[model samples]
Target chain A: MDAREDRGQQDISGIYRMYSKEVYQYLYHFIGSREAAEDLTQEVFVRVIKSLHRFEERSSMRTWILHIAKHVAIDEYRKKRLQTIFAGTLLKLLPSTEGLPEKELQDKEERTHFEKALLQLKPKYRNVIVLRGIREYTVKETAEILGCTEAKVKVDFHRAMKMVKEVALHIYEKGAGVNEIS
Target chain B: MKFPSDEEVLQEFRNRPDAVPRSEFLHTLERKLVEVEQQHRSRSKMRRTTIRLGLSAAVLLAVFFLAPIFTRLITHPESIMTTKPEAPLVLKGQQLKLAEVSPAVKQTLEKLFNLVPELKTMEPKVIGKEDGVYEIVFYQKEQGKEQRYVSVEMVAATGKISNYENEKAMNEEAPSPTEEEAKQMSAAFLQALLGDEFKQYQVSQNANNDWSSVAYTRYENGLPVFLDRYYVGVNSKGVTYVNTPEGAQPPVSSEAFPKPGTFLSEEEVIAKVASLIELTYSLEKDTGKPLLTYSLETTGYFHAETGEDVESVSSHTSRYSDVISVKPGGKKLAARDADEVAKVMAEEFGIDMNGVSFEADERILPDKKGVEGTLYKSSGGTEKIMVYTNNKELTGFQIRGKIETASSTQHDNKPANAKLTYEEAKEKAVQFLEPYLDSSVKELKIDESQIMMPTSTAYSFSFFALHDGVVVTDQNYLVNVDGQTGQIVNFMDNFMKPIGPFPDLDTAISREEAVKQFLQSHPVELGYILPVEKETLQLRPLPVYSVDTRAYFLLDAISGKLVK
Candidate 1:
């Protein structure tokens, strides 16, 4: 232990320990893949590393980190739009098999079914659904995360949940098609 | 461990070790971070960018806006504006008009006005950020500038109201709420607003102002965590404070910040704090032992993680880094007659002293106790200059000019006396002061020296006499050299303040006893403060237990009691 050792700055590890799980979960739902979420979580921390010095204390560490994760989600979404097939292939490579917080969505069937229906949603619908519904952020917070009006977040989340219900009903009618991951 | 850049971090994911089941994600990232840190630390210090000195109108406006007043507004309770709204009717920067708000919001506003009698006379400034979230700001009446009485953000969509701030104590005539009543009332308000989540917060009285002050620090594992603080304002007529800025974390959970519990013991914390201490001279604050002798820079707080001692930012600058690079050249400045001074004053400072005569004033605030000086005053008495010298040679001169600033010398041809660099200005300052350097004074160390304007306008310098390396802080000998002309702009020789009839260090209490008194007087408080990350100059929030630097201002040597 060097007396002048830079442990204070190394508390980035502490920060990562604190916020990484939430960031991973946020990225996981937003991106619709477990492996991609893991990679993007790493990406979020990397961005955190570069921008940590510029982190203003006005906002909490969690809020700032979530803001960064939302940015990563948007960038990933944009790349999925531009780098379509490449991102699509990478997203599909990993199944939602392991390390799922079982307590969040009950049994495996419900979790897979919810995830499956979520994957079917458009970016706009998925954004509102994930932020407002799952994260339980306020309309103002969700609007801030999505960079849109509260009206839009409110309307989108309602419509998105309606669409999810329709999709779930459609899947259950076909005896819950688990093979159709994407 | 240092954090890694994500692009470089991707390869580590590819090379993720399979054997390490306990998660090497942090370890890999830590290694990458340390590698980055090593590379960064090896780099040379960035050059300080020099800005050209220019006294623009914007700078003048800024000075008027930011300059602090002597009588404290909150504490004095006698007063307190973005720009104090003129006449109360002319509200500036009101984004949302009364007509712009919904009918429901109008009803809500009317209800609030009737609920609180103070709201009736106050001017309302409503600013709506979203569809339903409206921030209604109320300003006080015509006696003083428009003081914001309350700023509350209401969420109409979700039957929730957040971000309520009541500055009732700002009103000089506002009633007082005792510390206990304030806590109870504020706690009730917070409980209603946050529902069951308010139970986690521990109430503590903020002892700054005369009025009611309370702060709710979120407790986890029976210890207050960083981030989540629901503060109560000066007075709580309405809800005091419900986290003003939208992004501020609510008193929801302390699952994120677990660093508070890991803080070092008091002895270890004191031990770590010793690292920030350096042998420096400080003018003891009303010390039972006189003679501004040796004092330690024992103001730094301990990093709770371990032994790393981080220096806390104190309001007063340390005299340890004083540079006396410039020696006296004995270039004595001769005393100028009234006409000669008037010409320089008019040309340089834009002051018209056409018919003003220098009147002798025995008792003046400008110079030392017995030094005879002439006061040059214009007809309006707004612009006054005190010249502290006989007709023989110049000792010092103090100027208080009118609103319009000193005219800047900006020439294209580059005159013989162009704006001098910091070093050049120092030399010029020495030339002016060399003649007045009394041989009776002990080592006169330069306490502070800096260029006034970023445009290299003027070089301001202050020298203090030190007794055996310990500086007498109030030895206010000062000199300001004009950066443009390299001429002496302002000079003062007020170092004749009687310091002491020296005391023996042996009679003083032990250093250990002094440290104990310091800790006893100023208890180390647990706080999450943003310390600038030296590796990148970013603010990193660190939770540490440390005494307030303001409170731990001065330590007494003999009585072993810390002085504010």
Candidate 2:
């Protein structure tokens, strides 16, 4: 490879090393599937490699990469609708929060319920929660990634938190007896 | 049950197991990147070689065939050097997968299949041309002894199930769920789609039978957010359909909108609304009867600070008008006259007005009193422009079609000295609009002006139109000037001609008395209130009010009574 191409590859490798885990976690929480998240992470890197030269530095590199990751996840979602159908079923088959102490199990269950609730939320809401709440990015940073105003990011983050709280509370109180459509 | 704090929620999320990629993921990615780089380099090399060979061949051919070609170019320069037309800026619908359309839709289908495991055997097919909606159909299949067929129409825009149909027959002995049961079922379904906060949406059943529908509206801080609502339908089989607004979500913040202080008493608010009311008339469709309608001339959301409504940032120009072409009645202009105007539109704006029908209507212009204009509507019903017959002046026009090309000569040529200061652009805009500024044009103020920097820089100026001293809530004009030449690139004037015998301002009811009358009827209900911001692609949160009924109505200034 040419020296310039070799330098470009090195830059891409450095970016992947710094961001792959963060991007994967964000996509995982969003799509509720590790397999899909991993696949989309690769796609995100591929896109980053392709568009890296054209990136005008309008936002920070982290925010720009996250933005690309978001698009990749959304595009993958559109391409694999049926695979998403199996995500919940696979999640349900996971081993119960047993063998642990009562309090630990309860906490685990609540966390699991919150994750499910996160999946239930609209994509926009989920985006704010993942970036601002879970990742603990600043509202400005989240806005840059989401391509929205900081005020909007703050508002959505607040609302998403309320929703997560409500969902977790409802699930904890009701248990698994909540109606499942037949 | 108490809700978890934001900290606790975040901690819970953080506690969840991290999704680490497989160990070989990076190795695989590195290999893929190498492959991509090789492919890109080879393509670039091939392109360069092809260009070099093509240039050499062209140079040799030009030497041999130069005389005739040069002569032809000199004879008809326009034919060989015509500019390519710019493609129209159209918002093409995106192809979407079901999951991408809405997470709730995917979850609902998964839940349905899980509940009826046999249905899983029949593959579901989702079809859609739009980005935010899709149709998923599952064909009837014989599973041992039973057959089932189901179809769901999902709208991802609103994250609501628009429709669901079960084509199989079930035993009549198994009755449908009661209205209460249906409400519970619908709530569960919404919770699955919208999360726990959606529980605030109280379901009110409209009908209780084999086919039943329940409307859901969210209540925050005791007051209802009436802006968005969801309708869920239940049949004997199960929950059949749900209709929701696009990007509908419950209020995010409970902080009282227009923070609770002494707001204008009901009496004062009523008076403000009454003073703003406009007396208008609308013709009955069937009888052509002119019915007097009192319109609340308020703009935007009701703000507590000023006790007066704020202006909406989004442009909604075509809604308010005293005279609309109802039946295409007036003196019909000659076809040639229509064609003459249509030719200007075709040549200048790239509007294909050929073979299109035309109608003339008498418009009551504030300046001209009564003027007749010809209206040409495109076949798609998207583009409509009206030109006066007497003066041949363009009056009203609405183009919903995509802008296909830079239709103006000023935009075609780039002038080296075309850089104009903001002051110069404003001066040019004023000069262009000076003819339309009459005594009736009150408070001619610039609403907004911005310099758009891109391929061709231009300054867009939006001017608000006011009547008398009050803001003419619906009337405004927008003009765009070329940054370099100071030439007008685009212009739109949406000022409605009021049919007057205008009412005297001094004769209006007192603000205090009007507010008193308004309070007596519309009691205050507490809810959240969100101020409207300028148009953006992001989803905006709605405002909520505490101890605010959130009801707004216009009152007739003369009578101090609510306008129906």
Candidate 3:
């Protein structure tokens, strides 16, 4: 399609038209932290302007922008960790604020448990699971976004599913313990 | 596509779409990006607009250094545009082959042309070969310089004179000089050195005279011995090189003939050193090439008088990475790779330490170049330190991950007179090591002295203790120290010297004069002058100087100055 389009000249209006809702929704489901997702989504577009030249046209514009967002989030994590260390703290706890609608709190809690489980996976497995199962990007799209071959993505996806099953078992066990206490 | 069993799990998470409030998130990031973008844009704009003007200013400064030299070359008639008819041809095709010429082959032929000064004026004969390199041979002799033909072979890929060999064939070709001829050459040298000291003294070849010739043989005292056949009668304040037959031509560059004393006079050495500093500084300022401050440290190696290789002395500077800058907070930083920094340092500073490596932390800059750092030295169970820079402010250094140094006191062989209060010794050491100090040394501490095993027959060893963070012991001579006086008995530090800052224009003129007299008989001219900016050594806007009359002159400058 319009692969040769000058993404830099397109500006915020073009970004809004093409990616605003999709990126927001992707981030929201991935993090379960509403504030971070919203903040990171905006940051992703800001970076788009700053690193316009690095978009080498090898990947779709959407995939390239998502890659930037991923790196930015990783940098944010590192910055926060360094600050905590400098402040003489042992751990900078992740934000755990629950902001789901009351009606969906149960589903949100399950997702939160899965998110913790996902964190236990290495970054590669976690990214694959999120892209394939959560974001619904196809295996090829996931490979292209990650700069890997489609076959490798499929293998990682299979391993991610197996890890999730293990995570699901742990979640159910924890739920049962809470029920017994109640 | 068939739905996976996990679709329900994914759909549940997607439906809720847990995200922070959109408006607040966008507001914070939008502000930060705008600020960063504005700052970057402004700096880039400034760099583009003002850089050209800065470069022109630098060119004007360089022209100031070159104006006199250029003028001298233009006005000289005998050498004006002297060229053999076939000078400008390229032999790049398959028609070339390689050949080797021996220095012995040329030396045998020197006697035939010794009487004719014009025959010595021929340029090095260039012979191209089938290999990707070319050879040029020339014979150079002046009243006082060494009589040898220097042959250089330059490779094609890097146009560098990869091979340099000297031939001594002149002795074989020309029979040994008759006693009368030797006597005449000796008389000429004696006149240059005699100056106002002794006008009418008789000259004789005396092997016993300390003022005899000193070029070919290494004497028992470690001084070079010139052939003893010619001598100058000296009734003088001090023996000088002018008395020697070859004194008129001294070495072409300082690398060949060194002044005979174990140590240079402080003023003499500093005066020479100051010119080098001026040259490096002006070149950087004019061409915009990276400027470096450099220093050299000498270890006694053997007895200073006996000329032995005893211990190693190293110097360092206060520069770390050229591209890395430590952020004020020390937690975050920006940098380029260490390899890039090393590459530029080698090109700019002439330092190519093997296995050169760096680390960035609160202590080191991560990715920038030209940053300053400290040097560390260790010897005799003690550590010593000095600051260093990559810019060649001084002459020589072997830069590495950390510069290893020892206090002057650690060397057991140092003269006893070198004893100073811990503070006094360090201050003296700094005079030599200061040009090489890296940014790292916050302070210096002197430690205890220990006797070291002697590395040579001339002296016993004593070491001084010192530390910055690393312990280094500097060497001293036990015999040279007066136990009752607690003072160093005999040590010379002329080589460890400091250079002066750039003097006013007239002094610059004198320096130009010295170089001019030095190059008076040589047949090379200033090629096209290119513009450079001082900070980055990057080319800037300006015209290069050159004469339209020569093709090979361009080749020589490219091979010499550019590689240098």
Highest DockQ against the true fold, candidate: 2
- Measured over the true interface residues after superposition, the C-alpha RMSD of each candidate is 24.1, 26.0, 26.9
Task: Write one digit per residue (lDDT tens) for candidate 2, span B202-315.
Answer: 545341112255677655433455445676655555665565432233234333222344556555555555565454433322233333334444443454545644333321
In model 2, the Cα lDDT at residue B298 comes to 45
lDDT of 1 at A98: 57
In TM-score terms, candidate 3 sits at 0.26
lDDT of 3: 0.35
TM-score of chain A of 1: 0.67
lDDT of 3 at B339: 44
Better of 1 and 2 by DockQ: 2
TM-score of each candidate?
0.45, 0.38, 0.26
Give me the displacement of residue A125 in model 2, in angstroms: 36
Q: Residue A113 of model 3: what lDDT?
A: 53
Better of 1 and 3 by DockQ: 3
Query: Model 2: residues >4 Å from true position, as ranges?
Result: A1-182, B1-109, B114-119, B122-200, B205-212, B219-229, B235-237, B246-388, B391-426, B436-467, B471-485, B489-501, B512-524, B529-543, B546-556, B559-564
Best by TM-score: 1
Q: Ten-residue segment with the worst summed lDDT in candidate 2 chain A?
A: A173-182
| lDDT of candidate 1 over B336-383, digit per residue (tens) | 555555554565345556654453322222222234344432222444
B414-445, model 3: which lDDT tens digit per residue?
43333344344433433433333333323333
